[model samples]
Target: MSKGTRRLAAGLMVSAGLMGGVVVGTQPAAAYPSNCHYGISSLGTVSAWCAGGSGSVRAVAGCEWFGWWTTAYGNWVNVNQGASHVSCPWPYGVRWGGFNARD
Candidate 1:
């Protein structure tokens, strides 16, 4: 191949690599469920028993948000009863919620 053609191919390959697999979509994609946010306050309420004894356990019902659901029926949680850290897992790639339980 001509030197100029080879250089152009190499430049194109480098540009593709720099893009980091991001595709420029012509239309904007739909947003996540209108309600879910990542925080304890966002997770309205949960039962005390379901809150777990003292480690990183799953959250109880009503303590999560999913795909516009005011309350997530089934959501996993990571609760640290003593240290002051809590985490909520969201399905479908939704945002997870974390909290300072001790605080």
Candidate 2:
């Protein structure tokens, strides 16, 4: 290619790269409730309690069915309120549990 064409191509590529980086870097962060506590019960219950903050928190329970597939369930509660809980269905056992926060 000619020198001018090559320069134009390089400039376009650099501009595209910079724009891509800006888009990737400018993504919004996740909102989570502060001062939260979580737990998993032996009966396949997942719970979360948030004593402070402005967002909401939820309990996430990962349940296993037929010893093969796993599914997740969740329940939400506002911050500074009572606990939120999620439970697996019958014949499904708890594989894991955790909490999530949202605005």
Candidate 3:
């Protein structure tokens, strides 16, 4: 290859590497916790953590549930009675008690 072509190629590779690093570093580093972590609330409601926060929501017995939802900003979005036992992505799994529970 010509000297000019070799230098240009090397510069392009370095630029690509730096750009890749910046892109990866700027991405949001969020992940769902390993478990739903069900617990009793102050109101005596049997609930589990929504996806990524500490908020609780009442789970319906005998319904598959995704108790809480993690918002875009990595916060818990609590659910209400009207929201419980609703058709979710994986179907609500026996919400409250641990009866073949799933989400």
The numbered model that scores best in lDDT is 2
Instruction: Look at candidate 1 and give me any clashing residue pairs.
Output: 57-77, 58-77, 59-77
Report the lDDT tens digits of candidate 1 across residue range 15-69: 9977755665345543322211233434433322123333333333333255443
TM-score of candidate 3 to 2 decimals: 0.30
Expressed as tens digits, the lDDT of each residue in 36-100 for candidate 3 is: 54543443334444444323343433333355531111112352212222222333333333211
TM-score of 2: 0.61
Rank by TM-score (best first)? 2, 3, 1
Decide which is better by TM-score, 1 or 3: 3
Output the number of the TM-score-best candidate: 2
Error of 1 at 28 (Å): 15
lDDT of 3 at 20: 95
Task: Give candidate 2's error at residue 101 in angstroms.
Answer: 0.4
Per-residue accuracy of model 2 over 1-103 as CA lDDT, tens digit each? 9999999999999999999999888956645578888898877788888886677888887888877656665767888878889887777888888888888
